[model samples]
Target: MKVACTEKSQILGSKVAKTLGLPLVYSQFKAFPDGELYLKTGALDGETLLVSSTADNQSLVQLLLMIDACDRSEITLVLPYMGYARQDKRFNDGEPISSRAVARALSAGVSRVITINIHEPSVLSHFRAPAIDITLAPEMARWVASLGCDEPIILAPDKGAVIFASEIAKHGGWEYDHLSKTRLSGEEVRIAPSSVDAKGRDIVITDDIISTGGTLATAAGMLKDGGARSVHAACVHGVFASGGFARLAAAGLASIAASDTIESAASSYTAAGMIAEAMRE
Candidate 1:
């Protein structure tokens, strides 16, 4: 088996390659002055694992090109962060199931697919090939445990994230609970149970993604108001879109940490080992 990676995921791909004891294949990528992309990879054969994170349209396009380049090789597509996964269903009439569309596009020329901490696990059903969804929750939990907080509490910003919080708490051996959120409008939200007694206790908010960071900011503020000693945030994918990290910091979070799924400044953990293990299985 051999390992290859797209430009954006090179760091993580190298880590995974090391873990798998596989030779890493390098690909050349270039953008024309007209804004078109070009990719070049050596002759691909045998079992080849292509690692990429579809974090944006450019990355997705590049990945598609790379997959097409691997002629006749058994391709194992590894998407550390699958974009458009949140839109797994058509919410209204005339709406596209974006996740399914993306999955269809990605399934082309691939034998199997693997993703880490994808937003909707159900999205795997959209793929024609066998798809595997892995989680970085345990790795994130280990990072939290290394923080060495004397009195720590794991908090989920919303009920949907309670499972993530529970995973962290379980691994870290701490108490955990989720906050209730009432969205009044796009910019306005109400977070509760407003009565968490976090006084003098370190709080860690765990979630799958931190896209806009509005929910996390609101939750952090509420925790601060509730007298938490300090607030930290962790997630599997840190999209940090539109100044999201700054917003979370401004909301009084002491620190923000995330896995290397998206390759952001907040990426303090690596899920390469986890993905490598899944590939072995």
Candidate 2:
């Protein structure tokens, strides 16, 4: 079977296809000045995997169109980073759960789906197919340990991220703590460390997603202020929407690393092999 990728997702998808011994299928993508997207592929294949990360609006749109192109064959969708997942629930009465809109568009032509550490698995309910959700904390922990940095400490940006931090800590055989968050508003928050002294320690603030990055940046600042010698980040999906990357960098993160779950600059490494292994089963 041949494999292909949506415009933006080609980068990471190519890596996965290469690892799985599949040829990279190419398609043309461009838009008219009037806002219509044009898409085409050379020939039809029996089955095709359409890989794309919904990191932003353009990717989301391209994924929908590509699914239509695969009408002749079965389509398996791989979205390492799924956007709008955190908004699965409506915070207010009139607010729409954008995840449903995204899920509906995605499930339209796809036969199955796979994602890594989705913000919420309940969002899978939006898809009408066999879905698999996985994580990359195992690889991340191994990498962190190999780094052999000075006195290490694992910290979760907030209580919601504690589970991910815990996994990494378990993998590295280290200790961890969570930062409590009081969401003041959609864009404002207050954070407090639940335990542990980070002073002069190598603080690794970890999380699944980093959209806007307000939470991670704040925690990083606090860690430094509280006497932590350094701050680093290892996120599963670097969803740096709204220029959150610059903000996080400015917040004093020494080195930021992210798995290739999203098409971003920090995806120096990947866990696609693990993802494919799960799909193979």
lDDT of 1 by residue, 1-281 (tens): 88999999999999999998999998899999999999998768998999999999999999999998996799999999999999988889999999999999999999999989888899999998999899898898888888888858888877787887887788867888887867889998667543466777898988899888987898788778877888899999999999999999889888899899989788899989898889878
lDDT of 2 by residue, 1-281 (tens): 67788777777788888878887888999999998888887565588877788777887888888888888889888888887888898999999999987887789878899888888989988887878888888878876886677658888877777888999899777888887766889997656467877777888888887778877888888778878888888888887878889989999898888887776679756867776687678
Question: Clashing residue pairs in candidate 2, if any?
Answer: none
For every model shown, what is its TM-score relative to the native structure?
0.94, 0.91
Question: What ranges in model 2 sit over 4 Å off?
Answer: 181-192
Q: Count the backbone clashes (under 3 Å) in each candidate.
A: 0, 0
Q: What overall lDDT goes with each candidate model? A: 0.88, 0.81
Best by TM-score: 1
